[model samples]
Target: MADSAESAAVPIISTSTSTSIANVAASPAEDEAIPVQRKSSSPVTDPGTSPGQAAPINSAHEQSEQEDSDDDSALGAGSILSETTSLADEITQYRYEHNRRYHAYKDGEYWGPNDDKQNNQLDIAHHLYLLTLEGRLHLAPIGDNPQNVLDVGTGTGIWAIDFADQYPSAQVIGFDLSPIQPMWVAPNVRFEINDACDPDWGYKKNSFDFIHVRAMYGSVADWPAFYRQALAHLAPGGWFQQIEMSVVPTSDDGTVTEGSIFDMWGKISLEAGDKFGKDLRIHEQIKGYLDDAGFEEVVEKVYKWPIGPWDEDIHMKQIGLWNQLHWEEGIEGWSLALLTRVLGWSYTEVQAYLGKMRTGIRDRKVHAYHIINVVYGRKPIPS
Candidate 1:
C-alpha cells in the first residue's frame, strides 16, 4: 500500500506549465507509474446557453419540502417541471464514450460523467458539503448583501439558487459546461451554460462582488488563468472562494495502508486529468495561485471528511455516512472514463479495480478521509 507521505511526491503530469502538478510524493513504484503534468489534448468547447427558459423547479409549495426529502431526490427531480425542463434547452447533444456519457460540445473536455447518476451524485455531494460546513453556503465574508455574484462550474445550480434565496437582493449567475441546470430559478438567480476557460468572458470588468467555485477541479484546464479571470471580474474588495476536495485520502492515525486501491484510484484519476489538460490534485496549490493572482487577505480552511460512519463525533459520523454514499454512488461514474479511456484498461479491469476501492472506502478501520479545502481571498481594492 502506498502511504500518504510516499504518494504525495509523484508528479501526475509534465511540470512544463506549473511545478504544482504533482498528485502525491509516493514511493518509486507509484512515481514510476505517474509523472509531471502536461497540457491535455482534449479541446475545450464553448458552453452554450439553454435552448429556452423553463419554469424553475423549486416552486413556492416546494419550500415546505423537508431537507431530508430534498436529499432523497436528485438535484432537479423534485420539480414538477423536471421532465420538460431538462430537455427543453438542449444546447449541445449528449455524447458517449465507453458506454458512459460526455458533453458533445467539447467532446473530451470534461472527463467526469454527466448522466443522471452523476447529477444525483453531485447533488448528494452538495448536501454533504452543506452538512460538513453546518449549512453555511460559503465562508467568504460577503456580509448581508452583495449586488453581483458568480458561481463558476455551478453543477445543477443548487448552490446558486440557494444563495439567491438567502440573499434576495443579490443577482447570482450560475455558469457551467453543461446545460444540466434547471431552466427556472429564483428571479435573482439564472443559469447559463458556458465554459469558464474562455478568455473573453462577457461580463463587465470588476462587476461581481462575489465569485464562488466549488468542486471544479477536473474541469479547469488552467488554474492560473482561471484565478486571473476571477480577479478580473471581481469588484473591488470582492471575495472569491474556491472549495475543492483532495483526490488523495489521508489517515491521521496511520490506519489506511499504502498501495491501497483508493490510492491507485487517486493516481490513475490524476493521471487521466493530466491527459485531459486538467489536474485533479491541484487543491493544495490554490492558496499560492490566489496570492500570485494579486488577491488580498487570502484564507484557507481544511476539513477532514471521513469516508465511512467511523468517527466518534455524531456530526462527523453523519458526514462520513453521507460522504461514503457520495463516493459509493458515483465511484463508477467517476472512474469508468479515466480508467478505461485514458489508462487503456478493459471494462472488466476497471470494475474489478473499483470493487477493491469501494471495499477500502467501506472499511471503517481504515480511518480513511479526504481533505476539503476552502480557500477565499478578496480582490484588492484600488489604492
Candidate 2:
C-alpha cells in the first residue's frame, strides 16, 4: 500500500472533497500499509428499479414473524463458494450468467473474494493500536507482556499492523475473504486470505490473545456459529470485539411521519436481507449469543448515531455526516450484491427506488435516525 493515490470515486478524505474522511496515524508500517488513504475506482453504478410498482414486502406481519425466531445456529452443511480463490473464475462466470457483479478491484473494493483496497480504511476503523494514544477506543487487558493477536474480517489489514507496531514483541495476524491485504506488512504482522466462517480452516485451537470483527451486519448469516468458533478457538484470557449498526431505522418522539424515508429504508434493507438469507437483526441478538457461548465479562455499548449533520454539537454533526455517507454508499454497495445480483432486479429499477430512499432521508418530517452498536467479551482464565 502507498501513502496515497490520486483521488478516485468517493474521496471522502480529500480536502478538495465536500466531506471529511476519518484517518488514523500509526507507525511506519501504517504509512506503508495501514494508514494509506486513496480513492476507490469506478463511480457508484446505478441499479434500476421495478418497471411497475409491486407490493413491497409487508413489514406489519414481518415484525411479528421476526419476534419468534432465533437467528443463531451452528454451521451446517454449506458450500465453499464464498471463499473460492479466483473470484474472476467462479464469480464472473456466476454473475455473467446470473446477473451477479462485483465492483471493479482497484482500491479497497473487495466485498467477498475479490482483493482490491490499496487504501487503509480498515486500519483506521479498528483504532485498537491507539489505546495508548489520547482519546481512542482500544480493547485492553492484554496483560503486561501480551503478544499474538488475530483480527477476523480484517478488511484492510490495518488493525493487525498497528497492533503489531504497538507491541513490538507481539505477532499479529489478520484474515479476510480476499488477498487485498498489502504484501509488505510489519515483520510481526501477517495477513491471510481465508473465510473466518469456515469450520475446517487449519488453525491450532486456543490460540490468540485478541480477536476482532467489525461491520459483518449482513455478510454473516449465522453469527452464533461465528461466535461459537471464536469461543472454541480463543486462548485463555482472550478477548473478542464486535461492532455493528442499527440499519438506519429510528423513531424521534415515537411518531413516524406518514411515508417516512427510513420506513422505506427499513423495508428495502431488511427485505433485501430476507431474500438473501442474511440477518440485519444480528446486532440485537449478540449479547444472547455471547453469554450462551459461556463467555464472561460481556460488555455491550450501543451508540445512537445521528443521521446527518443535524445535531448542534460538532462531533455529533460529523458522526451524522459519516452516517449519511454510510447510508448512501451502503445502498449502492448492497444493491450490487443483493437486489441486482441475488434478487435479479434490473439496474435501472434499483436506482430509481434508491432515489426515493434518498428523498426520504432528506425529508425532515420523516424524523428518523440510526445507531452503531459494539459488543465485546473475554474468555475467563482457564481453571
Candidate 3:
C-alpha cells in the first residue's frame, strides 16, 4: 500500500442526511458528521445496496475499561519481532478456557499451533489494516481519518495491531472476551476483554473515525443496534467497515449436490444458526441497515473464497495450499470450539462433521463458501 494511503487521509468531509433505505427498524437516526476521503457526488446508497450479510454493541465498565485501555496504550511502536515474542507469552499464560463453555469471543480466541503459519500466509491484520488504501473498493465510506477504530471480538490482536501500526496517530482499540494481546506494542492500539454489549464502553461521542467489525459468528444479537452504536460513535465523515463470511455452503458453479459433504455442512450449520437465533438472514440485508443508520457512500465487495482446496489460478492455488495447512493444524481449534461451545453440538458430532468439512476444505468439495462483504459508510463530515 502507498504510504499516503497507509497514513491518515486528507479529504473534504460531509454531513449525512436521512439516507435510510430499508424497512428494517433502527434507533432514531443518530446522524453524525463524518469526514470523507473521496470526492462528492458519490453517495453511499445512491444505487447499490444488498439485503442481508451485515453484522455490533453497547456496554460499559469504566474502571476495567480504563485500566485495560491504559495498560494497552502503554505498549507502542516496536519491532514486529519483539511484539511477536510478547504475543507468545500472552497466549501461553491465557486464563480463559476455550472449551464447551466459552465461544470464540474473549480471552480464548484461537492462538493455536497453526497461528504462525496462518499469519504468514494470510496476514489477517495486514488485510484489514490496509483496506482503507483500497479506495477503488470504495469500502472506507467514513472520511479518511477514522479516529476511533474498534475491532470487536479481536482475535490474536492481529487486526488491531496492524491497523494501529498503519495509522500510528489514530486511537484504535480491540475488544475480546480474552486478553490475548501483547504487553508491548504500538501506543495507539489497545486490547480489552469485556462483553461488547455492555453499557459502559466510555467512548467519546462522535469521536471514532471508523469502527471495523469482522467474523460476526455468534457474538452479536442485534446487528441494527450494533450499527446504531457504530453510527453513534462515528464522527461525521467517519466509516464503519464490517467484513465477514456467510459460513453458508455454496457452489462455485451454483450446483452443489445435496449428497455432497459440503452440502451436509451447509444443512447442519444453517440448522445450528436457526436453533441459536443467529440471524443467518442478516447476510442479505447489510446494505439496508447502513442506509437506515444514515451512513452514505456505502460500498460492498464480494470475493469467492474456497474452503479446502480450490485453485484454478496459480496464486490462489498457493494460498489454497497454505490455507489447507492451516485447516489441518488449526481447523480443530477453531471449528470444534465454535461447534461444541456455541452451537451446543456434542464434541463427537462436531468432530465427525469437521472430518467431512476438513476434507471439503482439502479436496475443495465441502464446497464451503464465504462472502466477504466490505461494507463502509461515512458518518458524513460537513460539505
Candidates 2 and 3 compared: the better one by lDDT is: 2
- Sorting all predicted structures by lDDT, with the top scorer first, yields 1, 2, 3
Tens digits of lDDT, candidate 2, 294-380: 889887755555555455444444444444544554555545456665567787887788898777655544445665556778988
Residue 325 shift from truth in candidate 1, angstroms: 0.2
Report how far residue 234 has shifted in candidate 3, in Å.
Answer: 1.1
lDDT of 1: 0.72
**What is candidate 2's TM-score against the reference?**
0.67
- Models 1 onward score TM values of 0.76, 0.67, 0.63
lDDT of 1 at 36: 20
**Which tens-of-lDDT digit does each residue in 1-383 have in candidate 1?**
12233221122322212112122122222112122222111222222443232323232223345436756477564564774556544446777766777775556667788777788788777776666555677878999978888899887777887787778667788877787776655466777767788874567678789999999888787889989989998989999999899888777778866777766767778788888678887788899999999999898877777787677665566667777877887889877877777778899998888889888887878888888888899998888
Please, what is the whole-model Cα lDDT of each candidate in the order they appear?
0.72, 0.55, 0.52
Estimate the TM-score for candidate 3. Answer: 0.63
Please identify model 1 stretches exceeding 4 Å from their true place. 1-90
Candidate 1: residue 239 lDDT (0-100): 97
Q: Which ranges in model 2 have alpha carbons more than 4 Å from their true place?
A: 1-137, 254-258, 360-367
